[model samples]
Target: MANKIISQRISPHLWFEHQAEEAAKFYTSIFPNSSIGRISHYTEAGHEIHGMPAGSVLTVEFTLDGQTFIALNGGPLFKFNEAISFLVNCQTQEEIDYYWDKLRAGGDPKADQCGWLKDKFGLSWQVAPVQIAEMLVDKDQERLSRVMNAVFRMKKLDLKAIEAAYGEPVGAK
Candidate 1:
Protein backbone atom coordinates (compact mmCIF):
# COMPACT_ATOMS: atom_id res chain seq x y z
CA MET A 1 0.00 0.00 0.00
CA ALA A 2 2.81 2.41 0.80
CA ASN A 3 4.53 1.61 -2.49
CA LYS A 4 1.31 2.12 -4.44
CA ILE A 5 0.73 5.50 -2.79
CA ILE A 6 4.28 6.63 -3.42
CA SER A 7 4.22 5.58 -7.09
CA GLN A 8 1.57 8.02 -8.18
CA ARG A 9 2.75 11.24 -9.80
CA ILE A 10 2.24 14.72 -8.41
CA SER A 11 -1.41 15.80 -8.20
CA PRO A 12 -3.27 18.82 -6.89
CA HIS A 13 -4.46 18.66 -3.30
CA LEU A 14 -7.44 20.88 -2.45
CA TRP A 15 -8.47 22.05 1.00
CA PHE A 16 -12.13 22.40 1.81
CA GLU A 17 -13.97 23.54 4.90
CA HIS A 18 -15.75 20.28 5.52
CA GLN A 19 -17.02 20.01 1.97
CA ALA A 20 -14.58 17.59 0.47
CA GLU A 21 -17.23 15.06 -0.42
CA GLU A 22 -19.75 17.65 -1.58
CA ALA A 23 -17.22 19.36 -3.77
CA ALA A 24 -15.97 16.04 -5.09
CA LYS A 25 -19.46 14.96 -6.04
CA PHE A 26 -20.18 18.31 -7.68
CA TYR A 27 -16.98 18.19 -9.71
CA THR A 28 -17.39 14.55 -10.76
CA SER A 29 -20.92 15.28 -11.90
CA ILE A 30 -19.78 18.16 -14.10
CA PHE A 31 -16.86 16.56 -15.93
CA PRO A 32 -17.52 13.58 -18.16
CA ASN A 33 -14.40 11.54 -17.38
CA SER A 34 -14.38 12.38 -13.66
CA SER A 35 -15.35 10.42 -10.58
CA ILE A 36 -14.92 10.31 -6.86
CA GLY A 37 -12.36 7.81 -5.60
CA ARG A 38 -11.47 6.71 -2.09
CA ILE A 39 -13.10 8.44 0.87
CA SER A 40 -11.38 8.19 4.23
CA HIS A 41 -12.89 9.38 7.48
CA TYR A 42 -11.33 10.59 10.66
CA THR A 43 -11.07 8.12 13.51
CA GLU A 44 -11.74 8.49 17.23
CA ALA A 45 -8.03 8.46 17.93
CA GLY A 46 -7.53 11.83 16.20
CA HIS A 47 -10.60 13.64 17.54
CA GLU A 48 -8.82 15.31 20.45
CA ILE A 49 -6.16 16.80 18.22
CA HIS A 50 -8.14 17.39 15.01
CA GLY A 51 -11.29 18.67 16.76
CA MET A 52 -13.45 16.88 14.19
CA PRO A 53 -16.08 14.34 15.04
CA ALA A 54 -14.92 10.77 14.73
CA GLY A 55 -16.07 9.16 11.48
CA SER A 56 -16.49 12.50 9.74
CA VAL A 57 -15.03 12.66 6.24
CA LEU A 58 -11.36 13.48 6.50
CA THR A 59 -10.24 13.14 2.90
CA VAL A 60 -11.63 12.39 -0.51
CA GLU A 61 -9.60 11.20 -3.50
CA PHE A 62 -11.12 12.08 -6.81
CA THR A 63 -10.37 12.34 -10.51
CA LEU A 64 -11.19 15.12 -12.93
CA ASP A 65 -10.75 14.20 -16.59
CA GLY A 66 -8.35 11.48 -15.39
CA GLN A 67 -6.18 13.81 -13.34
CA THR A 68 -5.97 12.71 -9.75
CA PHE A 69 -6.72 15.08 -6.89
CA ILE A 70 -6.95 14.85 -3.15
CA ALA A 71 -9.46 16.96 -1.21
CA LEU A 72 -9.02 17.38 2.51
CA ASN A 73 -11.68 18.57 4.89
CA GLY A 74 -9.28 20.67 6.83
CA GLY A 75 -10.71 23.49 8.90
CA PRO A 76 -11.10 26.93 7.26
CA LEU A 77 -7.60 28.21 7.80
CA PHE A 78 -6.99 28.64 4.05
CA LYS A 79 -8.91 29.32 0.88
CA PHE A 80 -8.90 28.70 -2.86
CA ASN A 81 -7.68 31.72 -4.74
CA GLU A 82 -7.02 32.93 -8.28
CA ALA A 83 -3.31 32.26 -7.92
CA ILE A 84 -3.96 28.62 -8.78
CA SER A 85 -6.53 27.42 -11.30
CA PHE A 86 -7.53 24.54 -13.55
CA LEU A 87 -7.42 25.27 -17.25
CA VAL A 88 -9.84 23.33 -19.40
CA ASN A 89 -8.84 23.18 -23.05
CA CYS A 90 -11.79 22.89 -25.36
CA GLN A 91 -12.04 22.23 -29.10
CA THR A 92 -15.48 23.61 -29.85
CA GLN A 93 -17.71 26.44 -28.67
CA GLU A 94 -20.15 23.85 -27.35
CA GLU A 95 -17.46 22.33 -25.19
CA ILE A 96 -16.45 25.74 -23.95
CA ASP A 97 -20.01 26.74 -23.13
CA TYR A 98 -20.79 23.46 -21.41
CA TYR A 99 -17.93 23.68 -18.96
CA TRP A 100 -18.34 27.42 -18.43
CA ASP A 101 -21.98 27.06 -17.51
CA LYS A 102 -21.60 24.08 -15.24
CA LEU A 103 -18.56 25.36 -13.42
CA ARG A 104 -19.96 28.86 -13.13
CA ALA A 105 -23.12 27.72 -11.43
CA GLY A 106 -23.26 29.56 -8.10
CA GLY A 107 -19.96 31.15 -9.09
CA ASP A 108 -18.58 34.53 -8.18
CA PRO A 109 -19.71 36.98 -10.83
CA LYS A 110 -17.17 39.58 -9.73
CA ALA A 111 -14.28 37.22 -10.23
CA ASP A 112 -15.30 36.28 -13.76
CA GLN A 113 -13.33 37.78 -16.65
CA CYS A 114 -11.10 36.61 -19.49
CA GLY A 115 -12.33 33.01 -19.25
CA TRP A 116 -11.73 32.81 -15.51
CA LEU A 117 -14.43 32.12 -12.91
CA LYS A 118 -14.48 31.18 -9.26
CA ASP A 119 -16.85 28.35 -8.43
CA LYS A 120 -18.98 28.32 -5.30
CA PHE A 121 -16.14 26.45 -3.63
CA GLY A 122 -13.98 29.51 -4.48
CA LEU A 123 -11.76 27.48 -6.79
CA SER A 124 -10.82 29.26 -9.99
CA TRP A 125 -11.11 27.58 -13.38
CA GLN A 126 -10.09 28.88 -16.78
CA VAL A 127 -12.48 27.62 -19.41
CA ALA A 128 -10.93 28.53 -22.73
CA PRO A 129 -11.19 27.15 -26.25
CA VAL A 130 -7.97 25.66 -27.59
CA GLN A 131 -8.12 27.95 -30.60
CA ILE A 132 -7.50 31.01 -28.47
CA ALA A 133 -3.89 30.08 -27.90
CA GLU A 134 -3.39 29.39 -31.58
CA MET A 135 -4.98 32.69 -32.44
CA LEU A 136 -2.81 34.59 -29.98
CA VAL A 137 0.33 33.00 -31.38
CA ASP A 138 -0.31 34.11 -34.93
CA LYS A 139 2.47 36.18 -36.51
CA ASP A 140 -0.09 38.70 -37.63
CA GLN A 141 -0.01 41.34 -34.90
CA GLU A 142 -3.26 42.94 -36.03
CA ARG A 143 -5.16 39.67 -35.81
CA LEU A 144 -3.61 38.95 -32.45
CA SER A 145 -4.66 42.37 -31.19
CA ARG A 146 -8.21 41.79 -32.38
CA VAL A 147 -8.53 38.51 -30.57
CA MET A 148 -6.91 39.89 -27.45
CA ASN A 149 -9.20 42.87 -27.35
CA ALA A 150 -12.27 40.69 -27.83
CA VAL A 151 -11.14 38.26 -25.17
CA PHE A 152 -10.20 40.99 -22.73
CA ARG A 153 -13.69 42.49 -22.83
CA MET A 154 -15.58 39.30 -22.01
CA LYS A 155 -16.16 37.16 -18.93
CA LYS A 156 -16.80 33.81 -20.54
CA LEU A 157 -14.80 33.38 -23.73
CA ASP A 158 -16.70 33.44 -27.03
CA LEU A 159 -14.83 31.26 -29.49
CA LYS A 160 -16.86 32.31 -32.52
CA ALA A 161 -16.34 35.98 -31.76
CA ILE A 162 -12.65 35.42 -31.31
CA GLU A 163 -12.59 33.57 -34.64
CA ALA A 164 -14.47 36.44 -36.24
CA ALA A 165 -11.95 38.84 -34.77
CA TYR A 166 -9.29 36.65 -36.38
CA GLY A 167 -10.55 37.81 -39.81
CA GLU A 168 -13.54 35.53 -40.38
CA PRO A 169 -15.58 38.65 -41.27
CA VAL A 170 -19.05 38.78 -39.81
CA GLY A 171 -21.99 41.20 -39.70
CA ALA A 172 -21.57 44.09 -37.29
CA LYS A 173 -23.30 43.74 -33.92
Candidate 2:
Protein backbone atom coordinates (compact mmCIF):
# COMPACT_ATOMS: atom_id res chain seq x y z
CA MET A 1 0.00 0.00 0.00
CA ALA A 2 1.09 3.55 -0.64
CA ASN A 3 1.59 6.18 2.04
CA LYS A 4 -1.45 8.28 2.99
CA ILE A 5 -1.01 12.04 2.77
CA ILE A 6 -1.83 14.28 5.71
CA SER A 7 -4.04 17.18 4.69
CA GLN A 8 -3.52 19.33 7.74
CA ARG A 9 -0.99 22.10 7.28
CA ILE A 10 0.22 21.97 10.86
CA SER A 11 -0.17 19.53 13.73
CA PRO A 12 0.77 19.99 17.37
CA HIS A 13 3.42 17.68 18.77
CA LEU A 14 3.52 16.80 22.46
CA TRP A 15 6.63 15.46 24.19
CA PHE A 16 6.13 13.37 27.28
CA GLU A 17 8.47 11.64 29.64
CA HIS A 18 6.89 8.22 29.19
CA GLN A 19 3.14 8.64 28.80
CA ALA A 20 2.77 9.26 25.09
CA GLU A 21 0.38 6.37 24.55
CA GLU A 22 -1.48 7.01 27.78
CA ALA A 23 -1.82 10.69 27.06
CA ALA A 24 -3.04 9.96 23.56
CA LYS A 25 -5.65 7.58 24.87
CA PHE A 26 -6.77 10.00 27.57
CA TYR A 27 -7.09 12.87 25.12
CA THR A 28 -8.91 10.80 22.51
CA SER A 29 -11.42 9.69 25.11
CA ILE A 30 -12.28 13.25 26.13
CA PHE A 31 -13.16 14.80 22.79
CA PRO A 32 -15.79 13.94 20.24
CA ASN A 33 -14.64 12.90 16.76
CA SER A 34 -11.38 11.81 18.31
CA SER A 35 -9.37 8.64 17.78
CA ILE A 36 -5.93 7.17 18.10
CA GLY A 37 -4.03 6.68 14.89
CA ARG A 38 -0.68 5.09 14.07
CA ILE A 39 1.82 4.24 16.76
CA SER A 40 5.51 3.85 16.12
CA HIS A 41 8.10 2.05 18.21
CA TYR A 42 11.75 2.76 18.80
CA THR A 43 14.24 0.61 16.93
CA GLU A 44 17.81 -0.34 17.78
CA ALA A 45 19.04 1.52 14.72
CA GLY A 46 19.12 4.77 16.73
CA HIS A 47 19.31 3.25 20.21
CA GLU A 48 22.67 4.91 20.84
CA ILE A 49 21.02 8.34 20.71
CA HIS A 50 17.50 7.50 21.84
CA GLY A 51 18.61 5.02 24.53
CA MET A 52 15.15 3.40 24.47
CA PRO A 53 14.49 -0.31 24.16
CA ALA A 54 14.04 -1.59 20.61
CA GLY A 55 10.34 -2.29 21.07
CA SER A 56 9.54 0.70 23.27
CA VAL A 57 6.92 3.17 22.16
CA LEU A 58 8.38 6.20 20.39
CA THR A 59 5.34 8.11 19.21
CA VAL A 60 1.57 7.94 19.05
CA GLU A 61 -0.60 9.84 16.60
CA PHE A 62 -4.04 10.97 17.65
CA THR A 63 -6.85 13.29 16.59
CA LEU A 64 -9.08 15.48 18.74
CA ASP A 65 -12.06 17.35 17.27
CA GLY A 66 -10.56 17.01 13.78
CA GLN A 67 -7.16 18.34 14.79
CA THR A 68 -4.20 15.98 14.48
CA PHE A 69 -1.53 15.70 17.13
CA ILE A 70 1.50 13.54 17.80
CA ALA A 71 2.72 12.51 21.22
CA LEU A 72 6.30 11.40 21.64
CA ASN A 73 8.03 9.68 24.52
CA GLY A 74 10.90 12.13 24.45
CA GLY A 75 11.84 11.77 28.11
CA PRO A 76 12.16 14.60 30.65
CA LEU A 77 14.23 17.01 28.62
CA PHE A 78 11.18 19.28 28.35
CA LYS A 79 7.96 19.97 30.23
CA PHE A 80 4.63 21.61 29.48
CA ASN A 81 4.10 25.18 30.64
CA GLU A 82 1.31 27.79 30.57
CA ALA A 83 2.93 29.47 27.60
CA ILE A 84 0.94 27.20 25.32
CA SER A 85 -2.50 25.65 25.74
CA PHE A 86 -5.43 24.03 23.96
CA LEU A 87 -8.52 26.21 23.98
CA VAL A 88 -11.90 24.50 24.01
CA ASN A 89 -14.58 26.89 22.79
CA CYS A 90 -17.80 25.78 24.39
CA GLN A 91 -21.31 26.80 23.43
CA THR A 92 -22.88 26.48 26.86
CA GLN A 93 -22.19 26.20 30.57
CA GLU A 94 -22.64 22.45 30.39
CA GLU A 95 -19.92 22.22 27.78
CA ILE A 96 -17.58 24.34 29.86
CA ASP A 97 -18.27 22.34 33.01
CA TYR A 98 -17.89 19.04 31.22
CA TYR A 99 -14.54 19.93 29.68
CA TRP A 100 -13.30 21.62 32.83
CA ASP A 101 -14.17 18.59 34.92
CA LYS A 102 -12.76 16.08 32.50
CA LEU A 103 -9.52 17.90 31.70
CA ARG A 104 -8.91 19.03 35.25
CA ALA A 105 -8.95 15.52 36.64
CA GLY A 106 -5.66 14.84 38.46
CA GLY A 107 -4.62 18.38 37.52
CA ASP A 108 -3.04 21.06 39.66
CA PRO A 109 -5.76 22.81 41.59
CA LYS A 110 -3.72 25.97 42.01
CA ALA A 111 -3.34 26.17 38.25
CA ASP A 112 -7.08 26.60 37.83
CA GLN A 113 -7.44 30.25 36.92
CA CYS A 114 -9.56 32.15 34.38
CA GLY A 115 -10.80 28.92 32.84
CA TRP A 116 -7.27 27.57 32.42
CA LEU A 117 -5.99 24.37 34.04
CA LYS A 118 -2.96 22.16 33.90
CA ASP A 119 -3.88 18.54 33.42
CA LYS A 120 -2.24 15.50 35.02
CA PHE A 121 0.51 15.56 32.41
CA GLY A 122 1.07 19.29 32.98
CA LEU A 123 -0.64 20.23 29.72
CA SER A 124 -2.46 23.55 29.90
CA TRP A 125 -6.02 23.79 28.63
CA GLN A 126 -8.56 26.62 28.44
CA VAL A 127 -12.23 25.74 28.67
CA ALA A 128 -14.32 28.80 27.99
CA PRO A 129 -17.64 29.65 26.34
CA VAL A 130 -17.62 30.71 22.70
CA GLN A 131 -19.28 34.02 23.61
CA ILE A 132 -16.28 34.99 25.73
CA ALA A 133 -14.31 35.73 22.60
CA GLU A 134 -17.03 37.95 21.24
CA MET A 135 -17.38 39.73 24.54
CA LEU A 136 -13.69 40.42 24.64
CA VAL A 137 -13.76 41.97 21.22
CA ASP A 138 -16.93 43.99 21.71
CA LYS A 139 -16.70 47.66 20.75
CA ASP A 140 -18.17 48.66 24.11
CA GLN A 141 -15.07 49.07 26.23
CA GLU A 142 -16.99 49.17 29.51
CA ARG A 143 -18.76 45.90 28.74
CA LEU A 144 -15.54 44.38 27.63
CA SER A 145 -13.89 45.43 30.89
CA ARG A 146 -16.72 43.92 32.89
CA VAL A 147 -16.49 40.63 31.01
CA MET A 148 -12.74 40.53 31.46
CA ASN A 149 -13.02 41.26 35.16
CA ALA A 150 -15.60 38.51 35.57
CA VAL A 151 -13.42 36.10 33.63
CA PHE A 152 -10.35 36.89 35.71
CA ARG A 153 -12.26 36.04 38.86
CA MET A 154 -13.32 32.60 37.64
CA LYS A 155 -11.48 29.28 37.67
CA LYS A 156 -14.05 27.51 35.57
CA LEU A 157 -15.96 29.98 33.43
CA ASP A 158 -19.66 30.56 34.16
CA LEU A 159 -21.48 31.76 31.07
CA LYS A 160 -24.38 33.23 33.06
CA ALA A 161 -22.06 35.19 35.32
CA ILE A 162 -20.14 36.49 32.36
CA GLU A 163 -23.33 37.50 30.61
CA ALA A 164 -24.55 39.27 33.72
CA ALA A 165 -21.32 41.17 33.95
CA TYR A 166 -21.64 42.22 30.36
CA GLY A 167 -25.23 43.39 30.83
CA GLU A 168 -24.90 45.11 34.18
CA PRO A 169 -24.69 48.86 34.76
CA VAL A 170 -21.29 50.13 33.67
CA GLY A 171 -20.15 51.23 37.16
CA ALA A 172 -21.84 48.42 39.05
CA LYS A 173 -19.65 45.84 40.75
Please tell me which predicted candidate would have the highest TM-score against the true structure.
Answer: 2
Provide the global lDDT of candidate 1 against the true structure: 0.87
Question: RMSD to native for every prediction?
Answer: 4.2, 3.6
lDDT for each residue of candidate 2 in 1-173, tens digit (9 for 90 to 100):
01344567899999999999999989989999998888889989988887888898998888899899989998888999999999999998899989999999999999999999999999999998887776787788998898999999999998999989999532344
TM per model?
0.89, 0.92
Question: How much is 94 displaced in model 1, in angstroms?
Answer: 0.9
* Model 2 TM-score relative to the real fold: 0.92
For model 2, the superposed segments whose C-alpha errors exceed 4 Å read: 1-5, 168-173
For model 1, residues 101-149, the per-residue Cα lDDT tens digits are 9999998999999999999999999999887776777777998798899
